[model samples]
Target: MSMGRARSVVLIGMEGHLIEVEADIGQSLPAFVLLGLPDAALRESQDRIRSAAKNTGIELPRRRLTINLFPASLPKSGSSLDLSILVAAWAAEAHVAGTAKVVFLAELGLDGRLRPVKGVLPAVRAAAQAGAETVVVAAENAQEAALVRGVEVLAAEHALQVASYFRAPGAVEVPADPAQEIQRVTPGSPHAEPSAGGEAAKDLADVRGQAEARFALELAAAGGHHMLLMGAPGAGKTMLAERLPSILPPLNEEESMAVTAISSISSGAASVTRLQRRRPFEAPHHSATAPSLLGGGSRIPGPGAVTRAHCGVLFLDEAPEFPRSVLDSLRQPLETGRITLHRSAGQVTYPARFQLVMASNPCLCGLNVGSGTQCSCTVAQRRNYLYRLSGPLLDRIDLQVQVERPHSAALALQQPGESSAEVARRVAQARAVQTERLAAFGLSLNAEVPMNLLSEQLRLPSKEVRALDAALDRAQLSLRGYVRVLRLAWTISDLFLKDHPEADEIDAAMVLRQSAGVRT
Candidate 1:
């Protein structure tokens, strides 16, 4: 028996494993065998590796090569393990040794060039977590990997280049970041539109003639509350939803990384860079499936639109038209700030801490009490239309505002309101105040205040506390609803520069909570 050894790596979901690739060479037959519970994508890596080996001028022995991926029962998926497997098979067959120092991961192109693989950022992080010494990956993913500290990383363009690095460590030069050569980027947008840099982002200023709706939106952003907008078809409800993210707070470094990870798990490495700069704006069609909204399928469970919109906005247009079950699925996440999908294989938890911005017509006919249109649907039809939105779902929503169609005079007379940047500054101020006020309790935003801690941390005077007690008793608010109102009251006070939400703050917030909201 002649023994040859080679080393290689495989990237699992947001993690990297140093795989033991052992190749046992025998003279019985020239057949190749791979013993590992690899998924279909990985099963096909043999051809890619073989072609890349031939193109890179690596000779394969004309004898049986039995390759084993150690941690034998662990499920392996994706072609990312191809390079590691190839190297391991070759090393064992060629009797190569002392490769344990280098960690290698990449997909091999037929031309022998090293192509970028998915989850490279997470994979690199996983390696760092495991105290890996040195890591080599595709040149394209080097910049992302370099973000982590404590590990020496080398990126190369082709398989031979990486192999050469292993053969002579510290000899191969790591490429510098070519960001200047890359296009000038707008930080919030990943994909470049021809007019992206020049065009303006959708702003709150674009929404017009809906003062109450605007106030509701501000409160929602200020307190991280969910909002529901009821209006006629042409009332700019959708436009308002689109602009919510712009007025909200920007993501911090840690939040940005978490957001990018969710995106990465969705579309792989390319996803990591895209759709992460800005707060996610996901508007699923009314006809989406439960899995499409909540996440599930054959492989590992992917993040749903709600999870993607974490630390962002989930805009559900035509909200009442969505399947009741899909809409109801939101209740758990809305309260818990995360969703867990339990499959027989395992449970996948994703952050669902997002502001839900839902817009729906007041009635099935798209108009029940607004301008430029008359009510056509029967009373039952209108009631049934609104009925589709179950009470449990509606109750979870923190703020519900009715948006009326623009007045003929208002539409004709006004210019666009203040720009998004102008409003974002004010919103940022309110958020800062919340951060300061809650700093003592290790909290920032008002919405994060749980009821158990509210009386202690946000302790109000007896008069104000009694008013809240009366409101809760009269309104029959759930434990969740009571906390949401307190959060909203706090936001309203901050908006008006009040130190604490006094009786007036409570009153102003009560108007929004009243059963007799202005329907028109």
Candidate 2:
């Protein structure tokens, strides 16, 4: 009997665990046994590895072979560990050495080629954290895996190259094509190509009128506040919502990594080539289910639209048309900025911090605005339409602006409105102010500040917040609404270059909060 060991990583959401792959060959029937609770995709890797070994000019001993993954209690899934299993089986047959400390991550083809896998960035990061110095991945994942510091990445195109690197006896060598050869990748290496820049930000200059709605968009961008737009159809609500990402500031390095990692897990390896600095914008259809928004799957839990929109925007157009359960599922993540999904396998938590933007028409007939002229819907119908969005969900939204249809004169004006660049500059400055003020509290935006922190560390004077206190007493605003109003006031103050919120800012924030009354 001979035994060989290798290493790999298993990713659970963005978290990863180092797994040891051990292969044992003994004098028994010609059969293979795989241990460790593996999902269906992983169970099929045995056939894939056997075919890959045969095509790579390596022969396996026709004896009983047993492969086991350590930490048997941990559920393993995906084909990313196929390379490590092949390596361990070969080592057990050829008596090869020196594979205990390196991590192998890739899918194996029947033709012996290596294929890229998703979550390489987070997997490599976890391996580096676990003290693994070297990681082998497919060429397509080289740039992404190299994003992690303190790790050497070996990019290979075929299983033979990795076998040769490990000095396995009788390994075949292919033609010396530069593209297929093994390449070493390191952090910030010039050899890795940069991402093809994404589409240009949509400019706000195209918008005609609705200055109040534009200002609300600015406040939402600056403070990371949630917003709702209520109006008739063709009132430019969708256009305005689409332009929100244009005015938001680019993500910092740490934020970029977090966003890129989540994107990789959700999309795949091909979706990301480098750390993306732009914030994500996710717009799911009204047909989307609660699990799709909250990240749940039949077997493995995956990131939902909320997780994909982390540090970015989650725009829900036709918000009232969506199911009430789906809309209300966002209540917890909106307040806590994190979501935990439970399945029979286990539970995984992902960051759900994002700016929420919902656009809705005033009534089912879409004619309730502007004196309710030519309206055909009953009073109960309009109320029920708005009630689709529960009061609790509406309270979480900070800016509830009513977007009126612009006049023909405003649309016909030849001159364009303010450009995205100009608005983004102001948004960036306001964000900088919030970052500086909240650094001590381990927060970044006005929307993220806790109630206790607002009451104690950054409280307003009694006179400045007198109106809000009165509203709380009158039951016009809940305790949560009062805290949100305080946050919006601070954001308004930052926008106008005020050191602290004053009475003017407080009243403006309250007006924005109460603009689109639920009872309307």
Candidate 3:
């Protein structure tokens, strides 16, 4: 019997585990058996590898072929192992010696073409972490694989390319630097691309009025606070929510890579050519199930809308229209900034740190606080309609502003409101101030500051503290609500370039916290 081994990575959630693929040709019946805890897709890779080898003019031994994936207890899924299996089988037949030094990650086509697989960036990172000197991926994934430093990447278009490299390891060529490749394709600073839904990117200047709503949106963007916009049907709530990304600052390099990795895995694309610095925004429909919103699958836990909006914005229009169960599932992630999905297989934690913006009508009839009341709903109906949003969830939201329809005179004015650029400049300044002040605590925004840290480390003036204590004495704010109000007060202070929050800033924060709709 002759045996050969190669390496690949198996992705479990965002993490990757190095897997050894060993192929053996024994003196038995001419059959193939794969041994490992493989999913359905991986169990079926034998035919793909065989066809690709034959099409690439490589002959496999006709004897019984057995492939074993070491660390046999790890559950391996996906077709990313096809390239490694083919390489190991060929090495066994060819008596090659250097296949173990490199990691392989690509799907194989029947025509011997190397197909790109998802999560290539994280997979390559894992390989580097495991001390692999080189990685082989499909041509399309070369840029993504090369994103990891300290490792050489080889790009292959067909199985023959990999075969050639293995046949003469010294003569193989290295792929181009990923930085250069990315710059060639995208020639400027990272920016936000149009959303996948094909909606034109909205701007803040489009709205004619609702200055209070606009200010609330800016504050939410500045502090990364969760907000609720309550208005009538035609009050431009959706407009303000959609334009939020434009006013938010672009993500830093580390955040961009993190966001890109999540998006690449979710979309099954190995590489993101245009690495966007703009924060992501996901808006799911009200009919979305809890699993779809929170990310659950039959076997592997998929990323839901909450995860996709990591380091970005998650907007839910018609917030009260969603099921109470679905809304309640967000409580844990909101407080912790991460979601741990537990399944029979295992548990995976995904980043769910996002600015949540929810919009809802004041009542079922949508005229509870609008200019003209044509409502026929009773008090009980109004209370029940708004009560669909639980107190716990409402308490997590820092700003709850009332959005009103534009007046006739305001709509008729020719002058536009503050453009997104102008508002984004102010937001950026506020964010920078917070970043500098909170760097010692390892926090970038006021909203992310823990309640204990805010209360203990941050000191407010005596007047401001007295005002907040008075509000607390009145039973207007819950314990959780009080902390959120303090965070908001800090954000307001940052915006005005104040060293600390004054009494007026505290009052503004309290107003923002206790605006319209049902309060916690």
Candidate 4:
């Protein structure tokens, strides 16, 4: 009887904790005991590990065996630790060489095959950060684990392959399975290929008219600000929102990895092969519940639409039709750029720094805005319908624009406005200017700049300041509204290539703020 040890990782949300796997064998009645706070899936791994070891020509001694996950209070979950536990148990009775410096991450099939598991990228990252010398993963996850530099990745298809690799270095080679072997790549590697048939080619020119809405969309894209579009049905509100992503700048390498990782975990994969630079866009239905939008689960809280839309857009059509509670759930993430879910098990936080775009009709009838004659609802009814959107929630939106129906003449002409490519060029230029200016503060866009920084360092001229002061004195804007307008002003300045916002820019921002159909 002997003792053996190995290492693995436990993923809690996106973070990973390195764990030590220890196995002890003793001469007693045949029994296997597992210690540490393990979830149901993990508890069942003992059966799988035993079957896999037997199938792979390795025999466990017919004696009392104990497996203990060190840091037992950490609450380990999932089947990813199967390989580590099996290796440790095998090493207890055999002379397995070179098994000291490698972390194992894979599920063991009953037939001794290695199966891929989720969160391998983050797990490998954690191991690397903890100074692990090497990582062993399934062949399906080899490319993903290879993304983390400074660690040697050994990928195998079966338990026998792993054992052979450890017993004699360079003895076992990864089997060539074209369908399963994703090409190895490192983060920011030039060899990384873009997704095929990437996001459908949406163009802004599809919309007939509503120049005001088009301008607002551009501003939102330029500064990464939240926006609202109010119009009657068939007034191009949805079209404008759908095309907004087309004109936004492509995500950088760091942002791409982050967005990709969230999508991977949400889809139950270690990594997605088709990585794209295009930003994510999510439009959950109005009937979505608070948990679906903010993320919740009985055991591990998953990322919701807001978190999935990180560094991108989250659009809500028919915004007023959504429940008040669901709408209110966004307030915290909007302010802090992240969502924290406190479940009975524990708390998990996910990044939700997304631009919000909401659209709704002016009234319940969907025709009250165009002509009062076509509306059947009374004034009070119309007011109450819009009143569903509370003041604090509306205050968080920076741009509010009224989208009117296009004139008959404009529709007949069918003249397309600027294409997405043309608008995207200007938006990218404006974003570059903002990034350069705000890099010192660790900010990337005007919307994220703090109010104090705006007042102390990014303030406008004296005349513009006095104009804003007069507007504040008249109670035309709240303090929060004031800061939002200033942020919008900066966006306007950046769009027009100005050193700083002036009276004209401030006035433009005020126009947007006052366009909120419902008065605060």
Candidate 5:
């Protein structure tokens, strides 16, 4: 009889837990018993281990082998543990040394090949945090695993190679297959590289009209504020939304790490070799469901659109067409900047601090605004269509701008408005001012400043806030709306290089918040 142990990691959303694989080999009838709260996929690794051993020419004595994942209460899933289980069993049977301190993270192919697994970055990071000295992963995942500082990473292609590392008896090198040498594209890889022209190609210059909407977009990007655009079909609303990322600032080091980790886990680690420096931009279709928008699974919840857009923009074009439940699912994340999904197995929270931008037509026919001569919808239909955007959700959006169709004279000139690079400069400058002003409170954006801070230490003179006070007294804006308008006024002041928001800034904020002619 002999015993051996190895280590692995199981990721529950972005959080990873270290798992110990303990194998006991006893002289008894040939049987393999895996004792851990493994899910369906993990329970199937036993057959894979047996097949890999046979294909690799490794001999296993016909005896009772029981493997127990310590802390048997934690539910384990996925094939990531396959390599560790087989290695632990081999060490017990062959008396191989030096596996207890090494963490193995990979799936085993039926042909004894090591396959890349998802979440390798977080898994390796967790192992390093758990004091594991070394980590063994497939060659495809080696680059990603090496990203974690202070951990030794080993690369291997097949189970034989891993066995050889431990000097296991009967282990031999497997000849490489020429046919398998072709480059394999990783899942979630970017479809195309950014244009050589960079942000200039996606520049706001391409959007020729709707100057009011352009100003709102700049304000939204500058302050990290949520915005709503209401206009006709051809008013450049979608174009404006698509170009928002161009004007936004790149993520800082901490935000980049958080975004890269989320991307690696939600997608696959293979594609994310380095941190994602640019802010993410996610635009889910109108037909998306609540679970898809909010992140869900049968067992373990995954990151949703909001989480994927952390420190970036989440644009919902044709917002009214989305199911009300899905649109409402964004409310919690909008306020808290994070989302916690509870599942039967466990609950995991993901960062969801994203700037929201929603574009919608004024009514069902989408032509009720401006001339309204081509409109076909009735008053009730128009009201109901707008009502689909719940009151609370609408209140959460700070800037609501009406996008008017550009005049023919403006279109004839073909002169581009302010370029994205120019606006981005102003946005970055405004952001720097906010970061310095709010540094004492641990905030970097005007939108994230709390209401108490705005009302107390940063309170404005009564004359400057009189318009907002009257609007509040008349119940035209809720308390939340009142606070948001205050935040927006501050952003306007920041953009104009003012020390404080004057009365004109407050009035302009109210105009943008109400969206002038658009009905909320």
Candidate 6:
């Protein structure tokens, strides 16, 4: 009973490890010592803990102090353990006599102030999952922890307050209702606007008219297809890509969590203070590297732009400006819908099922035969630049649009074209139709419709079907491209409320597929 000892769980990133805090009080020795492979930050906790306990009017036991974070094999990191270690030592020194009902998870400041700890939300949820009953955390992080239902959390601002709560019984003030804060929701939605990777949250109305371009954007979202927009510098390429998210649907609960998880692990990036509501919109600069685009690092591997854009849109303006290798790195995630960051700690796979919207010029000079201006770039330079976007990558893009400068009339005729909500209504309908069609096969959208599904399940009418066969033969469309066109056709038909693509839809889809050829 003379030994000062308490136990708590230590969280490292998303992982949790149980730690034992033991104290031996004797007249012989008067010093503090911590063991169990503590890192620099954890080791320095000695000063913070002592100062915090003293400020809270509790004396630090000077006899012999020992702390042990169990599962000694798992590397212990961060200051989330401060609360637990403090509680354990206090309970032992005060001789609480068989007290064992609560657990602590927080960081303590030397001033006795309770500070918010990173990844505590994940840790609190993990505790509930592991069947722990009571969790006490920093008052600052109560709201985040409260999101995990059925877990009773006690939040305190100072060490003194936390100690008082355990010694007595009272309704300690905790996080308030987060819902009361009015959020800038995507139009017509009853949810908060998401920050990390989201639907532009911007509307299509701001963009001058590009009727065909807007149509292409709708088709891209409907079919779950990647697109390439080629035009001169002044053309509406970037605007169209930005508006792509407006037509796209918002993320579901699971998708939101997946996005939050990757954002949480991003190095040098702070954890998301709240769950994002809108779909993510990431437009990395032309200077991004392959590893930054995908995922890799020296100590802890984190998700790249591709994974960060999971369940959202990844916009690459000046697409060709990105190094050939960087642009090519996306090929895997496009097909796999996930990216794995291989590190010495092991590979961490993050979800990357995002819609790709890429924009590039028709030539190196930013002008070409299609540009309203004269073409001045030499053929060799154009060829070299175009060649960079070879078959391996071009084959993946389902729709190719030659975005052009808006006509004066179109630009002036902004009669409030459409809000993200209106277009989202149609896109959601098309997605629903695709979901029903592919339910048995577990596919979500037309773009994901495998070649086998086209040939075997959703076969086209014989006459319209014959047209596709002849067209593919003459065009030499690869098997993958063939599937892509059919998927696009299905989406076009769905938009028009048709059960299947008619001959007209299939023809139109293929033309959109092969239009403007490659950007080169």
- Rank by lDDT (best first): 2, 5, 4, 3, 6, 1
lDDT of 4 by residue, 1-520 (tens): 3888889998888778899998889889988899999999999998998898788776677888899998898888999999999888876765355565679999999988999998787788889999997898887777677766788777778887777555533333333333544233444554433444374768998887777788899999999989999888999899899899899988877787677767767876545655547888899999999999999888879889999999899999999999988998899999999998888888889999999999999899888874568988899989998888887899888898888889998888889888999999999999999999999999989989888998888877688767787888899877888898899999999999998888989999888877755563
lDDT (CA) per prediction: 0.70, 0.88, 0.83, 0.84, 0.85, 0.72
Pairs that clash in candidate 6:
4-23, 194-277, 197-279, 197-280, 197-281, 198-279, 198-280, 198-281, 199-279
Per-residue lDDT of model 6, residues 87-125, tens digit only: 777766662422244557778988787887766655766
lDDT of 5 at 474: 95
Each prediction's RMSD over C-alphas, in Å, is 5.5, 2.3, 4.6, 3.4, 4.2, 5.7
Candidate 6 segments whose C-alpha is farther than 4 A from its true place: 2-37, 95-103, 168-200, 261-274, 369-373
Each candidate structure's TM-score, on Cα atoms with residue i matched to residue i, is: 0.85, 0.94, 0.91, 0.90, 0.91, 0.86
Better-scoring candidate (lDDT), 1 or 5:
5
Query: How many residue pairs clash in all the candidates, one count each?
Result: 11, 0, 0, 0, 0, 9
- Give the Cα-based TM-score of candidate 4 against the true structure: 0.90
Which candidate's TM-score is highest?
Answer: 2
For candidate 5, what is the TM-score?
Answer: 0.91
Task: Predict model 4's lDDT versus the native.
Answer: 0.84
- Model 1 lDDT, full chain set: 0.70
Which residue runs does candidate 3 get wrong by more than 4 Å?
95-97, 168-200, 370-372
Q: Tell me, by lDDT, which candidate is best.
A: 2
| Model 4: per-residue Cα lDDT at residue 61 | 77
Off by over 4 Å in 2: 168-180, 194-196, 466-480
* Residues 1-520, model 2: lDDT tens digits: 2788899999998899999999999899888899999888999999999999888877667889899999888999999999999989888876355887789999999988999999998999999999999999998899999888899999999988887777645534433344566789976578566644477878899887888899999999999999999888999999999999999998878888899899889886656788887889999999999999989887668999999999999999999988999999999999888899888878899999889999999999998886898779998998899989998898778888889899888878866889989999999999999999999989988988889999998988899889889989999988988888899999999998899999899898888887776541
lDDT string for model 1 (1-520, tens) is 2554444455543345666667677877777788877778877887787788777666557677677777787677777777776666556544234555556677889977878777766676677777676777776666555555566667677766544434423322323233312221222223222211213568888776677777887888877777888778888888888888888877876777667666656665533432245677789899988889877766567678888888899899998899999999988888888888877555667788888888888787776764425888887787788888888887767677777778887778687776778778888888889888888888887767777777675778878857778867786655566666777889899877789988878777766754223221
Q: Write the per-residue lDDT of candidate 3 for residues 1-520, one digit (tens) a residue.
A: 2888899999887788999999999988888899989889998998998898778777677889999998999999999999999888877776345897679999999988899999887788888999998888887887766666677777777877677656734432323222322111111213213223223467888978788889999999999899999988999999999999989998877887778778768886654644557789999999988888878896779889989999889899999999999999999888887888999998888888888999999999898885436877898899899899998899778889989888988888866999998999999999999999999999989988888887788977577778888878899777787888899999999999999888888889888787774676
Q: Where in model 4 is the C-alpha error above 4 Å?
A: 168-197, 274-276, 440-442, 465-474
